[model samples]
Target: MKNLYDLVVIGSGPGGYVSAIRASQLGLRTAIIEKYQELGGTCLNVGCIPSKSLLDSSKYFSLAKNNYSSHGIFFEKLFFDFKKMMDRKNEVVKNINNGVKYLMKKNKIDVYQGIGSFKTKNILFLKDIKSLKEKKEIQFQYCIISTGSKPSCFPHLNFHLENRILSSTEALHLKEIPKKLIIIGGGIIGLELGSIFNRLGSKIIILEPMEKIISNMDDSLSHEMQKILEKSSIQIETSLSVSNIFKENHEQISVFAKYHNGKEVKFIGDYCLLSIGRIPYTKNLELENIKIQKNKKGFIHVNDDLQTSVKNIYAIGDVIGGKMLAHKAEEEGLYVVEHIVGKKPNKLNYDLIPSIIYTYPEVASVGRSENEIKKDKIEYNIGIFPMKILARARTSGCTDGFLKMISHKKTDEILGVHIIGDHASDMIMEASIAMEFRSSSEDIYRICHPHPTLSESFKEAALLNFENRSIHM
Candidate 1:
């Protein structure tokens, strides 16, 4: 007997699993397939979840080692066990993985664990990861590719060297912190992993090809974050392209690079982390057989409806590219499922989606940046609030960032909101809500905010757009 499904999702990541559940909810018989034993994909396994777990644990340790002394809390001996921390992180990953499995069962979505490939228009070939020769076939009306992405490595530093060369995935599972760590990219992953071990006593040196870190974000946020990381003893060398990586000894590796100015530089470290970014992962999907149209970069081409060139087959998440965010993929999954079920759901507001960096004094932003508005020649008014004056920040001693609001100069409608301070990730959601309603700076300013809180800074910043006055400063 041949098994059939209304929708068959390939790659049980955020996009795949969510789409499968939604499809089943919409009265479609759905099935999801994963190559790995776990369903949460890279984000739950080695990317966002595990990295954030370690980062959060290290942040508290750092506070105990540095800030707690000022808060009148003294420790006789402050020490942390890397093994315990890693174990806790692994435990967290397992819990989330199990939760995902529960969701699939509750939704009655059939899950097949194996490598899936397209053999024809409506047929899929499946094989066990261990026993590739053992094959199974399934039929589906529609398919979604959401394999997610893998950590990109420098061309010069291959995984063949093993321990000396690390990707963000390997870095998260390290048994011991390196005395000196050299990161090759100054993007979100590098900055985050660097912050983790730096707090745990590793000397971090970031080598960025760009002139500024987080170059895609608001210039102010990047500049401020760079300064903060520098003060935390995280060295950053920008505008350099790596020329070669040489193994110095069993204990150290030498990195050679050149500045844009043609000056050669050398860096030696116990370990090197390559966090340049990620590429679309469509591994073993047999994309060539179907001839699904792909870009030069291997990203599957999808239209507004998330449908690829093959009408019934769709692609989302990192495989199709955008922000390479898990939430973005989740939204795309829901969107595709709804569209397939004949529901008229409004298109997602990509501009309003928030991007967050989980470093200490977390960074978050939504909508167009001031520079983006400037490039478009949009006359915009700006409201700025320094976090140093916030009572909550003063009490917490984490007053190192600010909140900025940009709005249409004449109408006062908010165009963007950028934050870099404690609870910035949580606080940005409020801004996202306000912007979703097309709220003006005046609108947000008039809303009541609790006193002695980090969020109050946004209200004050919004007030700046109207009266150029903030009550505190």
Candidate 2:
């Protein structure tokens, strides 16, 4: 007899596990299949969770070592033990991973360990790894594909583990910090990992094919971040094409690349990190039999409701591909499950979704940026307030970067908000909420904000838009 489930979610990533729990809550017999030995997928295992852990540790280390004197706090010969720091991050990740397993068990979601493929629209084939046993089939009334993605490795680049060549995954598990590190691709991963190591006293250089890192973001925003990174002594080389990588000496590797101006430059480093981005990990899914459609980039094609070509099968998160963020995937997973349970659900507002980069003076933004409004030829009024003008910033001694708001010139409705400074990620959420309610700049300005707070910057920016009068600025 074949096992049957009301819902079977393939891939145990954030999207898959969350949806499985929701299905179980809705009184459906649900099962989840994970190819990896670990339960929490890449985000929990290596990507988001672990990276943030390291970033937080590194930030504190940098601050204690360098800025303590200015804050009127003194610690002679301040130091950070790399081994201990990494161990703490690992412990945090392990706790979270175990918590996910507990949720699956508590929710009564069956977990199958191994690769899964679709046999029919409603049937799934599971391959057991340990005994090489094959499960004939399992039937499901509804399916969710949340296979997620993996880091892209260049075939031509010889990634010698012994020589300290690493991908973002391996970089996170480093035993010793490199004296000099050369990173390929200056997108989110490269910039983030680079920043962590850079703060730990590593000389870093980033190579990018585009004219700027974070090319999808607003040009001005990227410029602001570049300046901040430069202050940390990190170098960025844009519009550079890497020709080849070779071992120059017994101790160092030489990377050859051409600059945007067609000049060849050589870089020597103790280690090279590849942060080129990720491709959807759909290789073993055997997508041919089910005839599910995919985009040109090999990401599964889904409708506005996130339903694939097959009506009952849905795809979300990195596999479906928009921002490739864990939070966005969780939202989609919850929405799909609710919709399946006969609840009238609202579609995800992609516009209000915030993007955060956890470098020094973290970057966060939501809604359309000034660049996007201009590109679309929309008329908007812009208001800006520097962190230097905020009393909270002065107290924290992190008075760099600013908050900017974009609103409709005629309607005064908030269009976009961007922030690049301390606690930017946390502060951007309020702006996102305001925009979601279609609040105008005047409405935001009228709100009572406590004096001598970082949050006051939001009110000041809005006031600048309402009238040319911001009290602090």
**What CA RMSD would you report for each candidate?**
1.2, 1.6
Model 2 has how many clashing residue pairs?
Answer: 0
Q: Which ten-residue region of model 1 has the weakest summed lDDT?
A: 154-163
Tens digits of per-residue lDDT for model 1 on 21-80? 899989999999999989999988989899999999999999999999898999998999
Q: After aligning candidate 1 to the native by TM-score, how far in Å is the CA of 411 from where it should be?
A: 1.6
lDDT of 2 by residue, 327-349 (tens): 89889999999988898689999
CA lDDT of each prediction against the hidden true structure: 0.91, 0.88
Instruction: Give every collision pair in model 1.
Output: none
Worst 10 residues of 2 by lDDT: 127-136
